[model samples]
Each structure stands twice: as C-alpha cells, then as structure tokens.
Target chain A: MSSSTPHALAESLCILTLKSGIWVLFPITVVMIMVGILRHYIVLMLQSPPKKQPRAAIREQRALIRSQIIRATSANSPIPPTYYKSISQHLSQAFADGTYLKDGPPKGDAPAPTAPNPLTDPAAMDGMMAGMKTQMVMMVPQMVIMGWINFFFQGFVLIKLPFPLTLGFKSMLQRGVETPDMDVRWVSSLSWYFLNFFGLNGLYRLILGGENSADSSRDMTTPFAAAANIAQPGQAQDFNKLFKAERDNLEFAEGLYSWVGKDVDTRILKKYGRLPGEVPR
Target chain B: MDLTTSLQKLAAYRPKQSQKSKETFEKGVALLEHGGYLKQGDEGWDALERLALAALDQDNLEVADRCLELIAERFPGSPRVDCLIGIRMEATESPDVVLKYYDELLEADSSNAAAWRRKVSVLRKMGKVDRAVEELSALLDTFYTDVEGWLELADLYASCSQYVPILLISDAQNLMSARYTYALQSLSHALLLAPQNPSHFLQFAETAYLAGDITLSLKMFLTVVDMTDDDDGDVSPSDSIPTGMTLRAWFGVKLCTRRLLTEPRLLTSSGSQTPAPSSSNISTLDDLSTERLRTAYLDIKNESPPATEKELIAVLATLIK
Candidate 1:
C-alpha cells in the first residue's frame, strides 16, 4: 500500500471491501436515527413538570422585578411624582428591613460570613437532584450508544469519501484504524458514529419540532460545565444582599427620576402649533 | 363553518367582554362533544378550558363539568386545573364552599396566582369587600406586575367609595376622598406597568377627576388625547377632530376646563399638588376642546336621522355655549 500512489490505491478498492463497508455503514446509521427519535420521546417522558415556588419566594422575585422596573422607567416614568416618592420610599424601607425575605431574617444578628452549604438545605437538594436527573437523562443513552459502536465495529473501515481530505484528518477520520499508509479519506466506523452523533441535529429538528431534546451535542460539553453548578443549582437567593443592592438602585434612580407626563398640556399644545410663542419641544 | 374550521376557530377564539357566552358555548359544545379538537393537541386543551368558562357563564353546568373532567384527567393535581374547578364550584356552590376550595388549592401551592385571585373574587362575591381588599392587596404585594390585578383593586376601591352614604356628609366626604385616593394610587401602579395603554391613562384621569384634582385630571386627559391622536402633522389643528379615546378625552378636557374656569381656586388649592395650567392656557384648551367637540357632534349629527340631527345640533349648540 505504501508503494502505490494514494489516487491509484483508492481506485484499486475491491468489490468485497466496498460491500463490507456498506454493511458497516447501513445498520449504524439506521440505528442511530432510530435511537435519536426514541431519545426525544424518552427525554420528554422523563422530564418533570415545573414546580411552583412558594409565596415568599415569588414575592422576593417580584420585589426585585418591581425595583428593576422602577430603575428602568425612572427617566421617563409616567407615574406621578408623589406616588413615585411613596412607593420608592416604601420599597427602600422594605428592602432594608428584609420584609420580603423568602425564609425570614437570619437567626443571628448578622448573615453568616460564608454562604450556607446548599446540600444541607432540602429545597436546594431537591433542585440539585432535578438538575442531575435532566443531566442523566441526556447523558446515559449517549454513552451506551458510543460504547456499543466501539465494541461492535472496532477497527472496521466504514467508507472512503469521494473528495480527497488532507493528511490532517487522518487521526480524526481513522480513529480505530492504525494503518499509516491508508488514504486520509478512509473513515473508521467509530469516526462515522461520532460524525453522525453531531451531524444528526438538523435531522432531529426536521423530524421533530425545534424544541425537541434529541440533540445531544450540548451534553458533551454541559457535563463538565454543569458539574460545578449542580452542587448549588438555584440555591435560595440571598434576599438581604439583593434587597440592599436594589435599594441602592432605587436611591440612585431618585436623582434621575422625572415624570414624562408632567407637562403634557403645553407639550401637546405646542405639538399642533396651538400654544402661543412656543416651539414643539 | 365546517367542523374542522369551526373547531379551529373556537379553539383559537379569545373571550372578550362583548363576546356572547351562550353562542360560544353552543359552538364549543357542538365541536367538543365528539372530541373533534383532540387531534389539535395542546390547542384542544385550550379550547376545552375556554369552553368550560363559556359553559359556566351560560349556566350550562353539565357541559362545564364534562370539559373540566376531561381536562382534570389529562392534567391531574395541577394548580391551574384546581382553580378551574374552584371557579366551577363558584357557579353552583355557596361562597363558603368555593372559598374553602380556593384555600385548599392555595395551601397546596401558595404562589398559585389563579387560586389567590379566585379567593379574592369569592370574597367580593360574598359581600365581604374589606376582606377581599385585604386579600387582594396581599396578592398584589406578591404579584406586583399583574396589571389586571392593580386595575381590579382600583375598581374595588372606587366601588367602596360609592358605597359611602351621603347622610353623614362630613364622614362620607372624608371616606370618599380617602377611597378615591387609594383608587388613584392603585391606578398609578397600573400606569407605571403599562404606560403605553391610553385606557389606563384615561382611567387615571377619570379617577383624578373624581378625586377632585382637576389640574392632574386635565393633564392626564390631555396625555390621553396626545397618546390616541393618530393624525399626521399635516392636518391643521382646527381641521382635525378627535375620535374614540381621543374624543372621550376631549370631553374630559371640556369638563375639566369648565370646572377649572368656574372655580379657579381649584388650581391654587393646597389639595391639588400638580402644576396647574395658567388661566390663559386653560382658556385656550377650553376653546380647542369646544371646537373639537363641536366637530365630533356635527359628524355624529350628519350620520343621524333628519329629526335627530336638528335636536343634536341644538344640543351641540348648548353644549359648546
């Protein structure tokens, strides 16, 4: 094989080899597609319904949202000045007093210097378990499929591409095949399986709608990225700190606040050239 | 319409205040009875829920029960479905039963917004207005961005104001003003959340007018007129007549201006904190509003019968005079 040119060696492929290559390619591709469809349904079945947060949790979230709204709308707020002052003062006082804390004030006079262990909190543990379950649902089938392909099709050259590839692709396209003299276009079965794994995303989207969970490419990267997050997934927010931050935001907004509707009569009059000696400012 | 088309239409139809519930119930039942919408998947469930509400509205308890049963079977132990069950109970059962059901649902999921709102409505329906107000205020504290909740709270406050008797003039006046103040505050929150909606601004203006702040009311009315004014800049101010909310706002502007001119002390009064329009600006606004009202009335007169046109013209003459 080293004595022959790559072009001539590619042309010399026998009928039996090509037939075996087709046999290796056909079942893997079909089984992969079937597994993808099955995985979509299985993930759907295994997914848990979203749990509603408790009342205090919702109030904490909405209180933050209300402060953000005030910050965003302060420059051109339509709320009158008196009402604006009262609500802002009320929110600032509430935030300082921890009136909207989810689990109430800390037992001690001060919050702990370090965050509490999330694993010790039952609610946080439940959240982590939920995250882990979804991660498992996404990951388990992929490992099984990869392992099956590796076991059954080890060292098998699946197919050669029509277009020539550079020598740089040899390690990627000939993963289990160790022959150095083989043309770079010759792909191993495992390499083909990896290609199908990443490339079938669009196919799944075509078969299922856009929101289907069949696409497993993200699972490859998410496990490592989410490992650190899984320990404290959506742990109870520190409302005291958040409230202090929002109080500062609301105080900062007070200096910038101006009611947009304050001068509407003159503004509209000037808009239609109705107000005397005034331009449409 | 055929079964498929009518089913699709009924499934997609959103209920509005003016929608005929009886007709909706009939159409919804005709399709839903045989599960014609089942193939529509999620939309079928939506149609079922809407039909249940329509059936409840029309007092068709049997059909409503069937729809609710199907939905509850599909989504067992769901808070949303539980709220729908509570609403169904509200139609037939006493207020106490409905309230208990809502309380149980809330106990299961405290943040169930629908269940909380239903509990408040049940309290209101039972003529426990103060209790309803307390519950609703607490609900709003949690669901601060709920624009409809704020509007409903404002309406309840207004209703409370109206319920005060005139026999105790001083107490009624004080209580009435206090209630209107609360209503105004609630409406202000609604305005903060949805500033682009002209109707909220109109509501604020009307509430301010009722609260005896003619200055603030006039400004809000003018804001509404500005918001709803759709004509391009090319139309001369004299040639353009306001319509719809703008027409209503023009009437508001007329009312505010008349009151302000008759009692100019409303501007200098300590109770009215908003910056007042000048006497000259008020007179000009009055003229502009009167001109617009005259054009709107004349346009209406042109569309009326000959006999009513004369009467309308006479009324218009007296109105602008």
Candidate 2:
C-alpha cells in the first residue's frame, strides 16, 4: 500500500487539472457549434437566385443537343433513312450558316478573336463579387474565433487525452503552452479550438442535414476551385467554333446512318425469327 | 383502417389525372378535418399538393383555396406554390384570365418553366393551336431537356394533321404531310432524350403508320418488340405470350403487316429510297405476328373470367382475320 501512494497522488493531480480544463473546452465547442449554425443561415440569405439566359443563348445550346442526338442514334440503331437525311442535312446547314450562334454570323474574316477581359464584363464582375461574399462569410467568423482563443485562453492546458502519444505530437497538442517536459496528450485551449473547428463537421451534418453550408473543410479547397474558374470568367464559349466542330461530327455520322440503316427492315425481320433464311440466335 | 394507417396511406398516394378524383378528394378532406395528418413533415406537403389537385378536379373550390392558402403560408413566394395557385385558378377562371396570370408569373421570373408550359396549355385550351405551337417551340428552345415538352409538341402537330379542311385536296395533302413531318421530327427528339424508354419508340411507330409510311412503321414496331423482350429466360416457352407493352407492339405489327399486304403500293413507294424487304419476308413476318397474337388472346381467354371469352373471341376474330 505504501508503494502505491505516489502513483495515486499523480493520478489525482491529473484529474484536478483536467477538471479545470473542461471550462475552456466546453465554451469553445459550444461557441463553434452556434457560429456554424449562424453561418449556414447567413450564407443561405446571401445566395442569389440563378439568372435566366437570353433566347438566343438557349437556342444555341439546344441546337447542340439536337446534333448530339443525331450523332448518338445514327451509329447502332435503325433510324429511317429519309428522316436521317433530312435532319442531318438541316443541322449541318444550320451549323454552317451560323443561324444558331448567339451573336449571329461573325462580322468579318478576321482570325479568331481573344476572349473578352473578365474585369470588363459586368456579368463576370457580378460572379466574382458573389464568390467573394461567400468566402468572407466563411472566413470572418473563423478568424475572429481563432483570435479570441489565442487572446484569452493563450496557454491554458484544456484536456489530457486518455491514450499515449509520441513526442512528435507535443507541439501540435500544446500549441500555446510552453512546457517542453509536459506530456504530448495535454491539449491546450488553442489546439482544442482547432480540433473543434475541423472535427465538428459530422455534428453539423447531423444537425443541419446533408447539404448545409456549415462545413468549414470545404472552404479549404475553394480557393483552388475559384482559381480554375477565373480563366472562363462567365463561361462564354465560342458558339461558332462549337457549331462547326459539331457539323463536322454530324457529317461523319452520315456514313454510320447509311451503313446501319441500309437493310433495317430485313435485319429487324431476321432478328425476330420472321425471315425464312436464318434462325434468330 | 385506423386513422393513423389511413392517413399514412393517403400521404403515400400520388393521384394521376385518370384516377377517381372525387373519391380521393373526399378521403383527403376527411383526413385533413379529423386527424391533422397533413401538418407533419415533407411528405405532408406532397400530400397537400396532391389533395389540392384532387379538390380542383372535383370542383371543390373552397377546399382547394384553403389548401393553397396553407401551402403558400408555409412556403412563401415559392415558384412551385405559384404554379399550384395558377392551376387552382385554371379550374375556375376563363382561359384569358388564366393566361394573364401565367404571364404575370413569367414576367416576375422569366425562367419559370411551369408557368411557360401552363401558358401554352391555356392557349391550346382556347383552340388557338398555331399560337400554342409557336409558344411551346419557344419554350423548348430554352428548356431543351424537357422530354414532356417535346412529346406535347409532337401531339399538337399530329392533332393538326387530323383536322385539315378537305375542300382543297392538294393543299390539304401538302399541309397534312408537313404536319406529319414536324411530328416525326419532334418524336425523334423525344426518343433521343429518353432512349431507354420503349414507349417513345411505340409512339414513333404509330405516328409513322398514320403518316402513310408503312415500312418505317413496321420497322419501328419491331424495334419496340425487340426492346421490351427482357430475355430473362423466365418465360416458359409453352405458356409465353408477350404481355403489356410487347403485346401492344405485336398488335401494331399485325396491323401494319395486314395493311402492307393489301396495299403493296405503299411498300414499294416508301421503300424505293431504301431497300424494301422482299415481299415473301413481309408475308412471313405477317404470319408470325398473327400466330403470336392468336396464342396471346387464347391465353388471356383462359386466364380471364368466363364471361369475357365471348367478347375476347369477337375481338380476336376481327383482329386475326
């Protein structure tokens, strides 16, 4: 019994420290959850309804859909030969004439022009503003909370984890605490704040359902995503070039139409075991 | 059933246009007044929408108004709710009033697809089919992925072909042909949008038959039959009769084959541009379709009540001969 006295004292000391640490841990966690919920509502309110495209833009898109249909169906199926001929001819002609282009036919034989500057386009500017607004909504609360944790709870050791960790984790788990001899399992208040920031993602999903904007981890990747979209600006493609490419594709598919549709009636009859010459497999 | 169970059933029920709307309305009203089952959860909103439509169908304007009011209060300024209000008004208002309402909705939000479709339908209901066609075409230009829109356009064109004034025979023929050509074009779009559904192929085949292209019609009919074959090997060879859609396709095949046999001119004329199947092969297909149809009717006669046999035999006689 005398040999166990020092061990008991050390265990009790650990428990006393952990009990004090609970104050810091509990408040930071609660504040994080509340801020996440508020941020979700704020983002929802900030989102704008999708804008409608002009009639010419819609026509340009659907004309592409029509050509895509012809290309897809003419390969393996039995489209009536005359129907195929008329549709393919009409589409190729429309593509060549630039009838479906949003701005109508090109003005002159000038070489393909450079893409318009994104900063000059009002629509592109609006998109950039919207993206920035969402980023600010996500970042401001995080930065404020991080600064708050660093200011007041600077070196408070919040909790001691039950499992043992290597010496490498001492720096991560005791962010502001300066005791080099302390156990790696003792998590300081600032480290606790960071943990709650990332680890409450599942909790947010539970409270707000699957598609809520409360997730902070997703914001980590948005900067890279926005960088990729910056090149496209307003997603304005060159419709004349697309239409010409599609026309070439449809012209190529005309051969497929002729080959597949040549003996459609006979092939169908034979497949169904109606033709006398061959038995259906 | 107990109140809770019956309410659950009502919540799950999705009423189609051809269902017994009056009965559905009564049941839904009873549940709403007594149990308050429709005040719960997301499914409750769906049930409310269905009940509201049923109320409109039954001409219970008061109930429809109450339902719409509740839905609007819950989802304020929702485009779906706005469309529901438009539908409720369509039950009672003049076509012009309803058209104005839809136009107002469209003006507020120009991308409201339901509002655009309703406007076209109102124009059609007022018997201005040409105007309806023009509006629907414009709508499809924006909503190119709307398979229902394409189908509705095809139906409108086919209906136009039906009502040609026959006094000017040559002009009527030209107009009829042009209408059919447009209908075929629309159906082809629908087919492309939903390639996996067999019904579009069936519709295309029937339209081809109506357009006097017997060979194309026959080929399309066979395509439908092949598409719905299942090939699960669950079919016992002795008792097998193509059921449902396949059965319908077989009947279409029989009709097309018989027509071609009687009017060989149709086969030659349509087949001149493409290679026509030998006449012998068409007769063979005709025999095969007739035999399959006979066995199917016989199977149905055995499975059905005895009283239906006389009627079934009468139908079979007309169809087979």
Candidate 3:
C-alpha cells in the first residue's frame, strides 16, 4: 500500500475501534447489571423450601404438641391466645397461651460449609456468592446515581425561573431603587418586612421538609485547650463563697416567701432590722 | 352627823319634812363631805339623800330616778345629784351611754382626768376606738407630763397595731415601761427610714428582741453580727427591759443560735465558743408581745416539710425564745 493510504486507513481503524468499544461493552454491561438486579428481586420474593412429611407424621405431631403444651403450661398467666385451625396442631398448643419455644439447636445449627464442596450443596452456595458479588459491584454506582438525581431534583424544585432573559428584568427590579436620587425609602424599608414575612415561612418549610441529607458526626474533642499552665491557689474560693451565700439566701427567701407573701422579705427585714440601702456614715 | 343616826333622823322626818327641804339638807352635807348622807344647810335634805341611797341599794331604778329628780329640783346648783345621776346612768345604760355621761362629767370638770380615763375605757368597750384615741389625745395634750396618760395612750396605739405611733408616743413620753412595743415599732420604722445605719438599725431590732418579737430579734441580731465590725463596742439599752433582757444581748443570743446551728462557720467567728447550743435553750417567751412571735413561729412550723411534732416544737422554741 502507498504511504498516504496506509495513514488514512490507520486513522479510520482508530475511529472504528473507539466506536465499537463504546457500542459493544457499555450496552452489554448495562444490560447485565439490569438483569442481575431483576434476578435478585425475583429470588428474594420466591424462595421457600419444599416440605417433606415423614411416614410417622401423626406421631411426630403428637410429640411436638406435648412439648408445646409443656411450654404453654409454664407461660405467663392472664391471657389465652385465640385459636386458628390452619396452623399445625403442635403450633396450636404453643399458640394457646402465646408461648413459643424457638426451634433449632441451642448452640446454633452446624457450622456453615467450610468450603464449596459438592457434598454440601455447592450450587446453592455458588448462587449466593454470585448474588453477594453482584450486590457489592452495584452498590457504588447506585449510590452515585442516587446522589446525582437527588441533587438535581432538589435544585430544580429550589431554583425555578421563567427564562434566562427574565433574570435581567428581575435584577433590575431588585436594584432599581439603588440608583441615586430616587426616593426608594419605602421600597427599601418595606422590603425587609415583606421578605421576612415570607422568608420565615420558606425557612420553616425547609426545616419540616422531608430529610435527605447525610448523617452528622459528633466532634470528639476536649473542651479546654491544654496550654494555659498558670494556676491560682484560691481562684474560685471567693466566687464559690459568694455563690453559696447568695444561693442559700435565695433558698431561704423562697421558703419564707412561700409561707408568707413577701413575709420572708419582712422576716429578713426584721432580722436585719435595717434596709440594704442604709450605709452608716 | 353620824351616818346611821342621820339616816334614822331622815327616815323619821320624811313624813314631816317637804321633799325640797330634805334635798337641801343632803346638798349642804354633800358639799362638805362629797359622799355624805345629807346636806346640813337645808330642809328635808337628810330624808331625800337617805332615800336616794336606799333606792340605789335596793336597785329600785324608778325610786332612784324619783329621788334624783327631787334632789335636782330642790337643789338646782348642787352637783351631788348630777354625780348620782351619772352613777345611775352608767349602771343602767350600755357602755356607749355610760361613755356619754362620763364625757359630760369631764366637760363639767375639766380637771377630772379620772372621768376622762373612765370615758376612754367606755369608748373602747363600745368599739369607738377613734373616740377613745381622741380622749387619750386630749389627756396627752393637756397633761403632757402625766406618765399615766402616756402609758394609756401607748396601750391604745399598741392594741390597734399602730406601732410607729406607739413608738413615737412612747419616745415622746420617755416611758421606758413600753420598751417592747416601742422598740419593735421604732426598729421596724427605722429600718424602713434608715436601712443603711447598721448600728442604729440593730438597736431597734435589739429592742424588738427585748420586746419579744423573736423573728425580728433574730433578724436584727444576725444583721448586727453581719454588719458590725469585730471591734465594735457594745451598745446596750439604757432603760433595761423589765424582763431582765437587753435587746442587744437577746439579739446576740438569737444570732449566735442561728449561726452555730445553721452555719458552722459562724460558730467559729466567736472563737472558743462551741457550736453546741448554750447551757440552756431560750426559756419561756413570757413577754406580753410574745404571742405574736409564737403565732409567727407556729405558722412557719406548719410550712416546714413533714417533721415530727417534737421537731416542730424545737423549731418553735428557737423562734419564741
């Protein structure tokens, strides 16, 4: 091939490669994510094990009912649960006084399968692992998208204007009174009252509005700075004494006042036999 | 004349003598001996005076009235009948009417402070307190040096709870006998007037303590202790209260009690004095005004949070003593 032709072909290949990459992988990944989420929802909704009744089902039911009866007998007094026939007879016994003995070994069932071995039903385990991985992969992108939608949605509701050109008219209306020599005293003064009247209403509305914000974290710091090293031997003694004296006086006065309407004041007056205002020359 | 012989002679001459003559005789005797049976200068005076006394003794009001009437008609210038009439009016009428007669007696004899005092008592009994006060004022104005009048006026003011007036009146009279009422009222008013004078203020409070207003006493005591310099000289009441307690000392004891018991530090202020109660708690509050203090104590005792009766009594003892 000629040199120019080779160069043109190389440029065309680069363009084609970029277009194919975008077209093929991106769409496939999006489709796979959608499918995985749908599968999770369906499985969560439908999953339940099939029941296999033993040949000695009636004997087993009697034994279960006996144990349930024992539990019900020891249940707290004063209320008998309502009966229902659709539930098992043993459950009925347990339900009689609303007493329930939680089933399963006390120490928890056997350890979870250590490894994905066929004997431990590897297929179910594999499916659970796959679901968990899919959940982990989807979490970050899902959060980013949710945040984006919330931010834009709030912005749209918060800031609505008729058109870009109308902003100029609005700004002029806001600044019109500011031009020199025009008496906009009424406009300027009344603006505060009007804005306050409605601004308060809007602020109250915002506070009571549905919460969609990040949780706040508490600060974990000591209140006082450590650098003030000076100490006074009797710093608070006088203040404490004054505080205690005032507090005691107030308490006594309160007690005295309760007994007599301002009689305590009179009593204090009587005790002091003098007014606080009088200073002996 | 001998009273019995004169009475017999009047009885024998009553039928023979005119009623006017008997009244004249009674008036003549009455002038010389104010409570005599008969007048020496007149006819039939002995019989009438004898008859009046006999009628008054018999409680025969009608006869007494007739005898007094005859005496008055027969001896117009004689005041014996008026005196007799006043006695009869006081005995027969309500206090208000008696007061009127007493007032008349005072008018007739301006110097009759006895009559004025009687009138004051009658007015008071009739609930005419202002009239009683008026009578007292008259006595005070006319008889300024009369200690009796001053004492009576002081009593009247005290009965009415007019403390400040009582204090002023007592101080004016210089009647130290009224120290309790005088001290309390004066101290209270002084506190109101000159609250900053710790010494002067405490003096009145001390007097109140002497007067048996324990709460006020305690207050004044504590105030003195709080306001006075440690080296301040003791000022004692010049006229010692009759109860043998000085206002200053009583207040000091009360101050010491409250301080030692309520605030331990106060006990230490008087060094070497233990925080324990004195050798004896305050004894009986025997002063007349102590009832008011007792009432205040009981009122406060009731309001204190549920305590045993003994505890209440203890608190009350603190207040009254």
Q: Judged by lDDT, which candidate is best?
A: 1
Q: Give chain B TM-scores in order.
A: 0.86, 0.84, 0.34
How are the candidates ranked when ordered by DockQ, highest leading? 1, 2, 3
Would you list the clashing residue pairs of candidate 1? none
Q: Residue B164: error of model 1 in Å? A: 9.6
For residue B244, give model 3's deviation from the true position in Å: 10
Kindly list the per-residue Cα lDDT of model 1 for residues A132-179, writing each as its tens digit: 766786678778878887898787787879999999999999888777
lDDT of 2 by residue, B1-321 (tens): 343333223322322554577777888898778647556787777777778889877778898898898889888987777778887877889989999998898888776777788788788878989888989988886667777888889999999654334543477556766677678878877876787888998898888877777777787887787777655566532235777787778788878888888898887666315445678877887777766676777676665422343454457655434
Clashing residue pairs in candidate 2 (N, C-alpha, C atoms within 3 angstroms):
none
Local distance difference test scores for all models: 0.78, 0.75, 0.39
True contacts kept of 1: 0.63
Taking all chains together, each candidate's TM-score versus the true structure is 0.87, 0.86, 0.22
RMSD of each: 5.2, 5.9, 41.7
Taking the candidates in order, what DockQ does each have? 0.57, 0.37, 0.00
The local distance difference test score of model 3 is 0.39
Output the number of the DockQ-best candidate: 1
Residue B63, model 1, lDDT:
94
| Global Cα lDDT for candidate 2 | 0.75
Winner on TM-score between 2 and 3 is 2
